[model samples]
Structure formats: structure tokens, C-alpha cells
Target: MALRDFALLVLVCMLWAGNNIVSKYVVAYLHAPPLFYAAVRFGIVALAVFPWLRSPPRPLWRLLVVSVCMGAGSFAFMFIALKTASPSSAAIVSQLMVPTTTLLSFLLLGERLSARRLFGICLTLVGALAVMWDPAGFDFSGGLAFVLVSVVMGSLGAVLMKQMEGVQPLQFQAWVGWASAAVLIPASLVLEPGGFETVFSIGWRFWAAVTFSAVVVSVFGHTAYYFLIQRYEANLISPLTLMTPLATIGLGVAITNDPFDARMAFGAAVALVGVLIIAMRPNQAMLFLFNLRNRAR
Candidate 1:
């Protein structure tokens, strides 16, 4: 990667990390309804990216499925989880996505994983569990459970996305934004009483948070990441994304004054190591697919 691209990647990670803090603040501290908050964010995104919505991608059904899984399903579960889970712990636990994606690829795509990758998956699971475990209560919290569900939704979307071709980042985001808003809006209205009222009462601060998340994090941050991944090797790009969690943890501790004990640190270290292993290993399927596309282009 060029020096400029590396810098861009770091900025993207920082923006994403800040988004975790912003989301936690919106849903937890501000007491905004999780689904409502997500709905509003995606609604803004849908409007912002509506230009790309004109030419629907082929196999519209698959696109819609992938959009819902990666969009509203993942965000709703994650925002709900954040109501109970600290940003630091949640960031560490979210590393499970790396392993979960690999496992899903093996099962759904019939992709084979090397022994090293299997070991990494096991380690990632153990580490995520460790973070979820509450020693005092002698049981895991529901927050991380919801997070696990969120990770699975996202992993499924990622696996399914491999079958999609010729979908630009903004176009995919447009679909996700519109589809997620469509689902989440009704879900929030029916499930969360007075959600709209509460959000409206919160005033401009609420809109500011939503705007930053929608425009900066969802649109710009994700679009920039897609740009980099297209230009570089997936393996090279994947490991660098670990910075997002680290930055999230740091921001959580500093901004939220989150409780981070020795156990939390250990879990984060272990999970990140596992994620690193999985990311560092070359992804033959991705490379082959991208190479073919690039040649055709």
C-alpha cells in the first residue's frame, strides 16, 4: 500500500472506532431506543445515497437478503447489545466475526480451512467467551450473546456477498441503507413505544450523532475501506483493521471510563492474536475472484 493509502486506512479505523463510542453514547447514555436509532441512521444513509439506488444489481433477491443480514439485522442486534455491554468488552468480543466468517465459509461455501486457520478459529472463540464470562455472576451476559448473533448475521452476509458480482460499494450501501431503514422503521415503531417521541425530544444533539454515524461512519468510512480492499490484498488489509478495536477500547476507557480489568486485557490480547492469524493467512478464494475480475476489467 502507498503511504497515503496506509494513512487513509488508519483514518478509517479511527472513524470506525469513534463510531463505537458514538453509538454507545446514543443508545446507552442518551437512552435512545436502539432500533429507532439504527432506523434513523440508515434512513439518512438511504437519502444520502439514493442516487446509486437507480440501477438495481442483478439477482435482486440475493442483494436484498445480503443487505438485510449485513445491515439492519447486524446493527439492531449490536445496538441492543451496547445497551448492556461496555464498548471495550464489546469491541473485544466482536473479534468473533473473523472466526465466524471463516466457519460460515467452510460450511456454506464449501471452502476448506487449513489446520492453522482452524486453530485460529478455536482461539478466537475461546477468547470471545472469556470476555463474555462474568466471573462474579458465574455466567455470561445477554449483551455479548446479542453481539454474537450480530456477528453471525454479518458473517453470513459476507459469505453470501462472495456470490455477488459487479456491485459497487456505494450501490451496495444504497441498498443496505434503504432496505435496513425499511425493516427497522416498522420494527421500531411496533416494538418500541414512544421511540420516535423520545428521539425527537432529545433535540439537535441526537441528530448530530445520527448524522455523524450515517454520513461519516456508514458512508465515508465504509466506502473508503471498500476502495482500499479493491486496490490491495485482502490479507494485508484485514489485519490492519484490528486497529479499530484497539482504538475503540482506548476511546471507551478514556471517554466512557469503562471498567477494564486484567481479565478484559487478557481476553482482548488473545482474541486479537487469533484474529491476526486468520487475517494474515492468504485468502485464496478472495484473491482468485478479485484477480479474475481485475483481468476482465
Candidate 2:
């Protein structure tokens, strides 16, 4: 890769990593309601990207469906999980999306999976369980369920995004934001009492979180990701994103003083390894190993 591209890749990683730390602050200190916050964040995105929203190259309905799955479904569940699960745990569970997306593609899209990929998927599942197996943690069952749901929804969205054609990343992101906001608005109103009033009552900290979420995380971070995608293949991009979760775990430990137990460390390592295995194309992995051996020699 060129120096410029490498720098851009690093910048993308930093943006994604910062999102995890920001999410923790939003959920804990800002006291923002997850669904409501999502609604607001996407609302901003929709307006910001309004000019780019044109007739999608693909079927409009398909784009809308994927938008909901990727945007509303994923974000709603993820925010809920973040609220209850520790940041480190949430980060680790998010990696489950890689395996879930692979399995879903194999099932729904008739994508072929090799034996190694299958084994990697199993290992990912086991690692996810290990991450959430704390006996004394707060509501482990509920948190695990929520995080798993988020992973599934996010994975489905990702697979769907692959099937989609003709939508620019920004245009797709605009649709996702608006569609998610549309669904989340009503849900927030019904499920979260005093939703508007609560938002109005919150201090600047909450609004700061909202701004960061809308502008920095959603818009900037995703844009950087799309840029990388344009430059590189998905397999190369996805595995490098394993860094985001690892960064989140580190930030959670340093910033929030969250405990860094043996279980979490082991589980994260195992899960990340599984994710790498699943994401790395066979040829790419082989080449990588070959290069490593050559360098050693």
C-alpha cells in the first residue's frame, strides 16, 4: 500500500476505536436513552446527506430493507447491549458479526464455506460465550441475549449490503440513517416514556455525546470505512477492524477503570483469532504465512 493509503487506514481505525470509548461515555455519563439517541443521530445524518440521496441504483425497497436491518435493527440492539454490558464485553461480542455474516451468507446466498471457515465459526461462538460467562456479573443472561441479537442484526445488514448494487456509500448511509430514525422515533415514543422531555432536560454533556455520535462516529467513521473499502477488498478491511474492539477493551480498562479479568482477556483473544480466521481469504492467509516464513528465513 502507498503511504497515503496506509495513513488513511490508520485514521479509519482510530475513528472506529474512538467510537467505542464514546459509546461508553454516552451510555454511562451522558445518560442518553439508547433508542432515542439513535433516532437523533440518524436524523442529523439524514439531513446532512439529503443532497446526495438520489434514486438508488438498486431497488428502493431493497435498499430500505437493508437500511433497517443495518441501521435501526443493529443500532437499537447494540445500544441496549452497551447500556447493560461493559464496554469491553460489548466490543468482544461485536466481533460475532463476522461469523454470523458468514453463516448467513452460506445459508441464504448459497455461499460456499470451507471446513476451516466452519471451524472458525464454531470457535467464534465458543469465544463469545466465554466472554459473557461471568457468573456474578449483572444480568449476564439478558446482556448476552441483547448482544447476540445485535450481532445477528448487524451481520444480516452487512451481508445484505454486499448483495446491494449501485448505491454510493454516502447515499446508502443517508438512507440507513433516515430509515432508522423513522422506525426508532415511534419505538422510542412508545417504549421510553418522557422521551422528548428527557432529552430536553439533559445537560450539555448529553448533547455533546449526541453531536459526537452523529457527526464524528456515524458520518466520519463510516465514511472513512467506505473509503477504505473502495481502496481494498472487504476481507482485508474487515479483519483489520478487529483492532477496533481491541482498542475499545483497552480504552474501557484505562478510562472507565473497568476490570480486566483473565476471562475477558482470553475470550477476546480467542474471539479475535476466530474472526481473523473467518475473514482472511484462504489465498490471502497462505500468502501472509508464506511471507512471514520467508522473512524468518
Candidate 3:
């Protein structure tokens, strides 16, 4: 990746990391309904990008599926998870998106991972498991199951996204925001009573969270991410994006007062190293190994 592209991706990670904290605050602390908050956030995104929602792109059905998967399916599952799960735990579990995407790419897209990358994937999984080993609050529960499904939906959406052509991220998100709100607004009314009432009652903190997530994270951050997705192979992009979780961990500690123990630190280190390994091209990794051997000799 070019330096500029890498920097932009890092920016996306930061925005998304901040959203995890803010979204958790709204849902878990301020008692806003999860689905309702998501609906409003998408409402903001839909309005901002409504111009692009004109004619359907080339593949109408596939685009719709991608919209549903990336928008409503993933967002609903994540919001549900955030209802009970810690932000740090949610962030760490979400790194499964990397391995899930790579695996799907191998099966569906016929992409291949080098031996080193496979080991990196395994290492990252180990790190994630380590982080989840907390006895205090990290109990394996239904919330985690929702997050797992969320990762699967996101991974599948990204693979489908790679197959698409001539559809820019702006148009993609416009459709996502529009389609998701269409389904969720009604669903929120049916499933969770008092959703709109809660929205009206909540103050600036809620709106601030909604605006930051909708504008900064979803609109700009995900749009930038999808642009990269369209240009690169899924395996190449997915592992690098794991940087989001690491940033989330830090933000959780600072803002949410999440317990940051030694085990979490070690696990985070392992996961980040795994991400670097996967990010390195095969030849780059080979050269590093060769230099190491020469130094030892």
C-alpha cells in the first residue's frame, strides 16, 4: 500500500475505534435502544448520501444483499452484542473478521494465503482467545454469539463487495444507509417499544454519539474502507484492518474505564504482531527471514 493509503486507513481505524466507545456509552450507559440508535445513525447517513441512491448499480440483487448484510445484519448484531458485552471484549472478538474474511476469500474467491499468512491467522486467533479469557466479565454468552454472527455477516459482505464493479463506496453506503433504515425503523417500532421516545428523551450525548458514528465512522470511515476493499484482495485488506480493535482497546481503557490487565496487554501484543505478519507480502517476509539468518551466521 502507498503511504497515503495506509495513513487514510489508519484514520478509519481511529474513527471506528472511537465509535465503539461512544456507541457503548449510549446503549449501555444512557439506556438508548440499540436498534433505534442504529436506525437513526443510518438515517443520518442516508440523508447525507441520498443523491447516490438513484438507479441500482449493475447487479441489483447482489447490491441489495450486500447492503443488507453490511448494514442491517451486521449493525443489528453488533448493537445487540454491545447491550451486554464490554466494549473491549466486543472489539477483541470483532477481530475474528480478519480470519473469517480470509477464509471466505480462499473458499469463494479462490485467493491463496502463503504459509506465513496462515500462521499469522492462527496467531491472531490465539491472541483473541487470550483476551477473552477474563474471568470477571468475559463470560461466553449470547452477546458473544451475536458478535460472532456480526463478524460473519461483515466478512461475507466484504467478499461480495470485492466481486462488485463500477460501484463506488459512496453509492454503496448510500444504499446501505437507505435500505437498513427502511427495514430497521419498522422493526424497532415492532420489537422495541419506546425507541423513538428514548431518542427524544436522550440529550446531546446520544446525538453526539449518533453524529460521530454516522458521519465520521460509517460515512467516512466505512466509505474509505470499502474503497480499499474494492481495490485489494480480501485477505490483504482484512488483517490490516484489525488495527481497529487495538485502537478500540486503548480507547476503552481511557474513556470507558475498562479493566486493562496484563493478560489483555499480552494478548493485544500477540494479535498486533500477527496483523503485521499477515500484512507483509511473502517476498518481504522471506527477505526478513533471510536477513535474520545472515545475522545469526
Candidate 4:
């Protein structure tokens, strides 16, 4: 990656890290309804990017599926996890996305995985298990379980998205915003009664967080990321994006006062190393995303 691109990606990571802290605050501290928070966030994103919604991509069903998977499926579960999970732990667990994406490509896209990558996957799983270990009672963390589901959802969306063509970043965001809101709105109503009322009770603080997530994180940060990914190798980009989690860990400790003891630290290091190993090598799925624009032409 060029120095400039690296710097840009770093900024994107900072934005994402900050959003994670903001999300945890809203769901855990402010006691906002997780599903409702996600719904409103995406609803704001949909409105902000509505202009891009004009030119819908082809194979509309595929786009919609990708949107839901990446948007509502991942984020709703993540927010739910945040209701109990520390931002640091959630950030570490989300590294499972690297291994999960590779595995999904092997199963769904007939991609072959090398032995080294398989080891990386195994290591990542082990590290994730370690991070979620409740040493006190010898039980698993429920919050981390939801984070696992979120990772799988995001991984699936990324793999599916690699097969798509001619979808610009903002256009993709527009669809994701609309699709996620569509799913989350009704789901929130059914699952979290009076969610809107609770959110409304919070007033401007809720809107402020929603705006930051929608505009700063999704619109500016992610759109910038899409542009860079198109220009750079996925292997180069993937490892660098790990900065988001590291930054999240620091922010969580400082802001949220998360308990990141020795065990958690060791697990985070292991999980990140595994993710790094997976990211450093070329994979079919990453290649597909790198070549998406070329394939479209």
C-alpha cells in the first residue's frame, strides 16, 4: 500500500473504532434498545444516501441479500452483543471474520484452502474460544456468542459481495441502509416492544449517535474504504484494517473501563496473530473482491 493509502485506511480505522465505542455507550450505558438503535442508525443512513438509491444494481436479489447480511444481520447481532460484551472482547472476537470468510469461500465458491490457511483458521478459533472463556465459572460468554454470529453474517456478506459487479460504494451503502432498516424496524417492534418510545425518551443524544454512525462511519469511513480496496490488494488492506480492533481495545479500556485482564490480553494477541496470518496470504475470495471492477468491465 502507498503511504497515502495506508494513512487513509488508518483514518478509516479510527472512525470505525470510535463508532464501536459510541455504539457500546449507547446500548450499554445509555440503555438503548440494541435492535432499535441499529434500525434508526440505518434508517438515517438510508435517508442520507437516498440519492444513490436511484440506480439500483442488477441482480437486485443478490444485492439485497448482501445488504441484509452485512448490514442488519451483522450489526443487529453486534449491538445485541454490546448490551453485555465489552468493546474490547467484541473487537477481538470479530476477527473470526477473516477465517469465516475464507471457509465460506471454500464451501460456497469452490475455493481451495492451503494447509497454512487451515492452521490459521484453527488458531483463530482456538483464540476466540480462549477469549470467550469464563475462567471463574468455567462457562462461555453469551455476549461473545452473539459476536460470533455477527462475524459469520459479515463474512458471508463479504464473500457474496465479491461475486457482484458494477456496484459503487455509496450505492451499496444506500441499499444496505434501506434493506437493513426494512428488516430491523419490524424485528425491533416485535422483539423489543416500546423500543421507539425508549429511544425517543433519550432525545438528541440518540439522534447524535445515529448521525455519527450513519454519516461518519458508514458514509465517509466505509465509502473511503471501498475506494481504497478497489485500488489496492486485499491482502495488503486486510491486515492493516486490523488496526480498528486494536484501537477499539485501547478506547474501550480508556472510555468504557473494560476489564482487560491478562487472559483477555493473551487471547486478543493470539486471535490477532491468527487473523494476520490469514490476511497476509492471497485467497480466492479476496482476489475476487480485488478484481470486481475489472470483472464488471
Identify the candidate with maximal TM-score.
1
Error of 2 at 201 (Å): 2.2
How far out, in Å, is residue 44 in model 1? Answer: 0.7
- Model 1 Cα lDDT, one tens digit per residue, 1-297: 899999999999999999999999999989999999999999999999999998887899999999999999999999999998888888998899999999999999999898878877877878877787775752346488888889999999999999899999999999999999999999999999999789988888889999999999989999999999999998889989999999999999999998888878888988887787787755653554367579979
Query: If the candidates were sorted by their lDDT against the true structure, best first, what order would they fall in?
Result: 1, 4, 3, 2
Q: Model 1, clash count? A: 0
Model 1 stretches with alpha carbons more than 4 Å out? 136-139, 282-297
C-alpha lDDT score of every prediction, in listed order: 0.90, 0.80, 0.83, 0.89
lDDT of 3 by residue, 29-98 (tens): 8889998988999999999999988877878889988888899889988998887787887887777777
Clashing pairs in 3: none
Over 4 Å off in model 4, which ranges?
136-142, 282-297
Model 2, residue 113: C-alpha shift (Å): 0.7
Whole-model lDDT for model 2 versus the true structure? 0.80
Better of 1 and 3 by lDDT: 1
Per-candidate TM-scores read: 0.93, 0.92, 0.85, 0.91
User: 231 in model 1: Cα distance from truth in Å?
Assistant: 1.1
Model 2, 274-294: lDDT tens digits are 788788988875665478579
What is candidate 4's lDDT per residue for 177-256, written digit by digit as tens? 99999999999999999887898898899889989998999999998998998999877788889899999999999999
